[model samples]
Target: MVHIQHKVKAFIKLGSFLKEYCEYSKKPIDLVGINGSNLAQFHEKVTLATHKNGWFSQENINFSLLQWSELLTENNLDEWLGNYNLAANNYKTVAIIMAGNIPLVGFHDFLSVILTGNSALIKQSSNDDVLLPFLADYLIQSDPSFKDNILFTEGKLENYDAVIATGSNNTARYFEHYLGKKPNIIRKNRNSIAVLTGNESTDELHALGEDIFQYYGLGCRSVSKIFVPVGYNFDTFFKAIYSYHPIIHRNKYANNYDYNKAVYLMSEFKIFDNEFLILKEDEGYASPIATLFYEFYSDKTALLEKLKQDEEKLQCVVSDWPEMKTVAFGSTQKPSLADYADGLDTVDFLLKT
Candidate 1:
């Protein structure tokens, strides 16, 4: 634990250093690209939402960055930082297959493999190639020792003690069949869900929209579908979420909304929403492209049963409804350091291997 403390301090200090450069001096750090493409993408989303979706408020960027700083300081660094003495000395390499839906989605995996004292063999997602290598370069500057451990390439998987892979549902079977023989954690496409009772406050509904709209709704953590009581007032819900109007206005996003809306309209399907776009559903998960949303329910009992049946497809559930353990609403995009993938801590995984 003493070693962990020192490493944590180092990480906090490094993060503070980077923050100072970005927030105050405007000094650009070539690596990490936190202020480069990553921040650019986020800014682009906000701009698009303002112009297209009619949602203009910058709700949580500062708060999220503060939380990120906190995560750097408070999370156990030995668990994530290279602790050569603690490693079993058996595993020499850690192969990571990363996801790219949200901005910097693969960062945690990159951190896990490198910080746990193993060589990283990364298969960068085409969507996320810019950020991870940028981070690798940043970390290398922070500690020259890290240079040897981080690697980027494209090819077949090599001999490694453990592996972590994330993919869509159709590809999960292949990941399991091919990589399961080795010690691995293979992730499949899973959607975040929401459970709504008729009794939620307007504030709660507004916050839920943040989860759905943040990151332009591209994250696995984004609430793709909603579950609400049958008699809930559509007017009340729409009014509560109108603050997110900027999201529907961005060029790319507006195009998506327009395209998806046209498709649904041409099909002669009934739609819901004030003016933006929301779609009602009969059954099944996932929303359509045009600023779409869904809701369904017979009763709590049936809802739980249905959710149980599709447990494997679920990434996380955000709900104010009864019976949820870790449901979070507005803060969906802001995952803390402790939220482990597959409920497995990377440090513990590395130690075991």
Candidate 2:
């Protein structure tokens, strides 16, 4: 069995390499030291990732690298793992069905499986196929024991003890039909939202733009909608997010904005537009790119109650309100190791089942 300390050191080395590689301030570093060439060979994968998926912008990929780099540090890793005993006697293969909406979105599950000393049978999204394979290779280089532990499958999963699957609400039905009998954690579509009491500062509202605009508003953690109190003025909100208006110039985003705007215009629906983003009075949670759905609340009590009741359909709530489980305005994307998807603890599941 691979010792837990060995696995920890292997990931720590990987974190070091990522820290140096993601130093966007300086010139791009060559694959250096022991595992450098292996990583250097995968630079082409990054290019292919952005090329194959128009929504996977270069900035967003870098953002993912930076976030992972910060998370894999010795301090951070130890803190996260300290919560569990990490028993490794019973070895099992944990199959992962990852989503492709954002870069490295499935990595947390991969990490959980590996850190628990279980083999990971990964099935990556075609939209995000390149990066994780190379990352798996890096993990092996850091500790050769993992070479036998990590495997990627193009075909249907077989011989796995448990599953972690993420997909749209549509695909989830198929997964439920196929993998329901197995010990599994199946995730469906969930959107994040924010609450605005209208007492927000200019800077606070401005920082909120990061939550809405990051990753082109693609990730589950992205704030796709907001709940505002009655008599709320959107002029301040619109002005604060104007800094991110440059995102409209991107071709895919521009196409979406143009197409969605034309549809809304022809339908005679009421909307507030600033040529870059549209604000619609929508009760729905998920908003398309270049549009934000908002609903007006008569009071906060009913809104919080509604949010609590529908928590399964929501990923997170971005808010400055001190009353509830709120992430600060700009922090929805930067979840810690403990922030398990669908609020299910992967380590605990893998250990018990």
Candidate 3:
């Protein structure tokens, strides 16, 4: 078995390589630990990924890389892993069914499985197939022992000890029917929200825009809805998010915006439009792209209670509300390693399995 320190060292090297790659535009390429040929191949794959999925923009891919680069430090990994007992008598094969909503969405699962000395059988979404495999190759190069630990397959999944699947509410049912008997972590549809108290600074609201528009609002952590106080003015919110106007120029996002806006208009539902984003008074959490759903709350205490009752539907709550747990403005997309999806401890689950 590969020792845990070896695994940690390999990931730290991967983090250094990613830092250099993401900042290559600003500095000369220093291929000391990284293979130059592999870097070129990875660059080609980034281009291919963009061609295959319009939503996987180069900027977003780089952002994801940068985030992981910062996160994979030895201190961060040690701190996160120290919380649990990682020693295992016999490592199991953990199957990971990844989602393609945003770049590297399933990487945390892969990392957890590998770090715990378990083999990972990854079934990637076609939308995000190219990047993780390339990264896995890098990991193998950093530590050849990983060669036997990572596997990606398109065929039927068999002989896996545990499963971690991510999908929509519909696919989640299918996953349960098929993989529920195994030790599994099956995730369904969940959305994030922001609570506005009508006293936020201009900077705070602008940062909130980052929480909304990053990844084009496709990520589960992206804030899709907001809770505003009764009689709240929306003009400030619009002006704060105006900096994200360039997002509409992306063809796919623009198409979604135009289509949804037309449907609302034809149906004669009242909406607040700013030529780029629409604000609708919706009670639901999942808002369509280019639109933000909102609701008015009369009392903070009652709103907190309602949110508590619907916690299962929420992945994040962006707010400064002292009465509840909340994520800081603009930091939803940059989650720490310990921020498990659906608030379930993946590493703990894998270790126990």
lDDT of 2 by residue, 1-353 (tens): 34878988888887777766666224546656565665456556777888999988778887888898889988999899888877643689989999999999999999999888889999999999988998888888778888988999999899999899999999999999999989999999999999998999998899889999999999999999999988899999999989999999899999999999999999999999999999899989999998999999996788889998999999988887777888998999999999988889988998887
Order the candidates by TM-score, highest first — what do you get? Answer: 3, 2, 1
True-structure RMSD, every candidate: 5.6, 1.7, 1.7
- lDDT for position 80 in model 2: 91
lDDT of 3 by residue, 149-230 (tens): 9999988899899999999999999999999999999999999999999999999999999999999999999999999999
Question: How many clashes show up in model 2?
Answer: 0
How much lDDT does each candidate structure score? 0.65, 0.88, 0.92
Residues 1-353, candidate 1: write the lDDT tens digits: 34334434545665664354335323333446544554444344434433432222333333333445556654455343444455454446888887766545676776666555567888877655553464466556556666677777778888676888888887789988888888888887777778887777899889988778776776677788888888877777788888988766666667878787777779887877555656657465666544545766767988888888888767678876566555666777777666765565766677677
* Clash totals in order: 15, 0, 0
The candidate that wins on lDDT is: 3
Best by TM-score: 3
Off by over 4 Å in 2: 24-26, 29-39
Worst 10 residues of 3 by lDDT: 25-34
lDDT of candidate model 3 versus the reference = 0.92
- What value does the lDDT take at residue 239 in candidate 2? 94
The local lDDT score (0 to 100) that residue 39 gets in candidate 2 is 48
**Weakest lDDT window of 10 consecutive positions for candidate 2:** 24-33
Report residue 161 deviation for candidate 3 (angstroms).
0.4
Report lDDT (Cα) of residue 306, candidate 1.
Answer: 84
